[model samples]
Target: MIDHRRPVGPRTLAARAKAAVTLSASLRAAVSAGEVRRVVCLAPDPHARFAAVELGADFFVDTVLANGYGLCSYVFGWNPARQTVNAPAVDQFLGGYGDLVLRPDLATLAPLEPGVWQVVCDVEWPDGRPVPEAPRTALRERLADAEQLGLVPSVGIEQEATFTGADGAPLVPAGLDYSVAGLTPLRALLGDVHAAVDGLGLGAESARGEVHPGQYEIVLRHRDAVAACDDAMLLQAAVRRAAAARGVRAGYLAAEASGMGSSCHVHLSLSDPEGVPLTAGATPGEPSALFGHFIAGILRAAPDLTGIWAPTWNSYVRLRTAPFSPRSLRWGRDDRTAAVRLAGSGRSLRLEARFAGADAHPHLVVAALVGAGIAGVRERLPLPDEARVVGELARTPWEALTLLDSKPARAVLGDPVIDHQLAMLGEELTAGLDTVTAWQRARGDLRA
Candidate 1:
């Protein structure tokens, strides 16, 4: 929902500028003490670039952003194919990548440990030349837009992941949804994760086991849109590191061995500058007029936004086969099966987005959600009747790509985004066209 005129809210602009232009107190302390070995830049793809921390009179950023995972995906997934951390000559990768600069988001500076601090970085290019491929930049713009409209968007992102043995089996047994015994095996591991995020100043709100074996959901408390997305990214990294330390695998894969998918549901609400929920109706049990328009715009764009939700080839496979995945873009009051479920009533009203897989990018999801709703509000889009079940989500990458050209898609995501996404998906299809999967090997060998 990026408008042609990129509106900048005074409040969001100041907060963003503080992070971009000023050195944080923690960073200043490290720079002055020569304690920091490296300053890592966290990308949208969750990849990190560890560069030498220049301990001079003042802090400076010389890292370049180009041909990196920031704008492009890995050979297949969004992350590296191998588990590589700090390489021997990693500083070279942080060097020149054509021209774009990777500016450290000082506001996101947090201790990865003692001598290392991880931060989310935003891409900066020349004016009039927008890098639509920059996920962090896109998120900042979306938040600014929300603020300019005199609305405050609150978001809480809940992601489900699996802790499993090396053989790819769940650490605990299934059929123990929400049971303490079900989550007992990985208590220490998740506990470490909770502690790690706490060090980052974003503590975990709640944790629970799911019906899917080894699958557990970590709920992050709600915050402003930008901060909430940052929390989600950092939370995922903490979970992965915790799993590795415990000698178990942290699987955020959409589908697990048990045919259940891990979900990354976002609980979102829009309120006025005064902190009053605009989604609440004049009377109880009803929705505000603006809420209807918001939901309508989201429903209209859901078919196409599926490409962003399920970006990888395997992502859609899980949504199509997993037990708890949403069936359609249909929405209802407090409905779990619906893509966007309306939850709570009165001032507590919110939308629990149940469509995205565990691996979907948080910033992209929020941008599209807020942008589309704003469009509806601006254009006065009419609300449609709610069907228990309406249309199915895009079933494949090809389906998603085909729907990517729809009017609603362009309305929500501009042409540059659509084209970039199509290219990335096309790359995925080309990458796997000739490769044989293990499943194919097992099924086709010596058969017919």
Candidate 2:
């Protein structure tokens, strides 16, 4: 039951159309000037990056065709290993070999190679329908649902990653945990990253040293849910490019073999159409009924949504009992140990979701979070009492798979979308099971 009394915010349909048109014109001008030699288009998956390259001259005319019809199987051919999979017929029907439209948002375009400009694209079907399996589409659907409720959702993402120098050595050999000494060694790399992200128009709030050696975290200012996720993805890409330019590497892997894990923390809030906060109450440190219900929804849906938040096999490695990552389905005020932490007051009141790892897809994570919150509001779910400890979350990918296919996920994400996710994740799980890890080999050779 949406509150029909209020109107949609600035992100109305007409406004978006105008913005898109303006962006298209700008891209065409850049192409005509030969400022862009190669146009790199991309879309992201839960565990991989999908992309295609086009010559600049071809891009001008092809832009219309690509936006309307779509590129070839490039969107579907990519797998986690950076190799193409021989997708089944059913998969092909869904998205494996079909045309995928590339909508060029000027905001996401950034320089990569000397003459190459990369633009992050949203994948859609040939007829302009959003691909259900696409991460960006998932987030957009959830945002639309929130809008229908007369509420606007905003998100700020904090992502951490490890940095290695040209010699493949850790920038910091020991944990400093936010110490200035830890940041001093990596100033050059961090500086480059800041400049790159700023050039792309991603307003980076701050960059700081994290708990692990050779690790750093960058905070992006809050924005609408979809833009926030897009900024997060673009920020990650920018950091990587910046590091490479400085003769280093930036890894977003959840956990290294012998180092602290990296995480992608999401801070979410809801506001009314008039930009008034709906999350906080008049009293200090107290949340409104709407905020409480949203938290309740997230707790109930946490188990089922774990697969999206922690999508990879290595992702489970970071969900341990300690290390600042939440292992349980709990919520508390300013509590880092809980999966959801309440923070701020009045208009700034927001929920911090700490379950996601750096390796997870930003769009999918945002979708699961927002969708679950919407479900909570619809059901008028009750928030649990604040607690220091609670029941554990899904600990393994197999367990996450079971929870993802459960009734709760279907209730929120619909059958087709959940089914597609299950199929894709199932493939990754099966492949993982077939591989022999180093630990297995070492143990088996000595004992078995």
Candidate 3:
């Protein structure tokens, strides 16, 4: 149970929430007729968590995010850098997240289960300003910028995660990567997840076994930028539900098992407002000038992009220790080792961002990319040479934050938002580095 008495500190910011977005009343009537049992307001928070507020059938609740019913997007207490089982609360609540109003985007609403419908909400302040910390809002801002440029982004995401049994071991005995027979042990579970995602209206293009035992990857079909993020988050929720139903646990740790860590790969392509694909040149085989600029933008922004793409301390560990994940910001034609892999041709052409861990927030990843792309186009930056390796990724969150101490970081992510992340992640890095770890507990003292 949530502690209702956790003080929000100092003065109570008095407020009232109004559902003013044009979610048609017929949808509310469905709730009245028992067609819907609950309405869930979902948004991504600073920490890669889905902050939700559940509502009764009435769908008009003024008490949420106010009057002792607020939610924290950054209150998990496992050293911020670490993912945990059942740790104590961090109690590091900041009012900067503030009292929020759920402005539900009706277009993104979809059924989560039998009677619970999920809506991707635009969280706002009591005074009606959009919260800068909201990940979805960040992505939306990028899309708006894209619109100004007469371009819109198309995004598809592929996610990989491993499932474990009660014994803390992988459910599958060994790696049976990619082969259909290897996926046999997981077919039923995968089917349940597929059905669940479909039922939630988030369709997957494909699913396959991965290099790790009990690991699987689901590739979601591409959609417009915002919807693609909404679908990405929905697929995550669906997979966790499927895992729970099957008596297993899903793990999205950055270094779940060394080189086999789960990753969230984002594929981005661009098209004009007239719906003409703009990533390829007038010629059938070459990339357009715009495509080159966008790739240049991503490469330019990548060092600063590390904190968003790889948010946690474990993320840096995976980047350093894991094989296959990109270490340098390099672009290549279909080369999997490159940080930005230029894939497909014509309508299928897109850039695949391979740096983000499963723990990274999807919205911010896209937002940062969009901003970088826009900056590139505005400045007419030239694309670098096609190579498998170039500039390196930050080896630690601290290092990444240090890199963000410049104008480029502020340019890619707005100043306020970039400052907010730097502060939050900085606190974690300081606290975590001060504390001793399990690895060092034996490695250093046991022999000493």
Q: On residues 186-297, what C-alpha lDDT tens digit does candidate 2 reach at each position?
A: 8777888888877665566787787877888888788767667766877888889899987788989888644367888999998875667789876857878888888888
Taken over the whole model, the C-alpha lDDT of each candidate is 0.67, 0.73, 0.72
Put the candidates in lDDT order, highest first: 2, 3, 1
* Clash pairs (backbone) in predicted model 2: none
How good is model 2 by TM-score? Answer: 0.88
Per-residue C-alpha lDDT of model 1 across residues 118-223, encoded as one tens digit per residue: 6666654533244565556666766677778876777888888888899888888675478886667677887787777676656567878887888887776777
So what's the TM-score on candidate 1?
Answer: 0.83
**After superposition, which runs of candidate 1 have C-alpha atoms over 4 Å from their true positions?**
1-26, 33-38, 46-97, 126-130, 388-390
- The sequence of per-residue lDDT tens digits that candidate 3 reaches over residues 298-338 is 88888877888888777876798776688788988898888
Which consecutive 10 residues in model 1 have the weakest lDDT in total?
1-10
Task: In angstroms, give how far residue 124 of model 2 lies from its true place.
Answer: 2.3
**Reference-based TM-score, model 3:** 0.86
Error (Å) of candidate 2 at residue 371 is 0.4
Which model scores highest in TM-score? 2
Give the distance in Å from residue 5's predicted Cα in candidate 1 to where it truly belongs.
Answer: 32
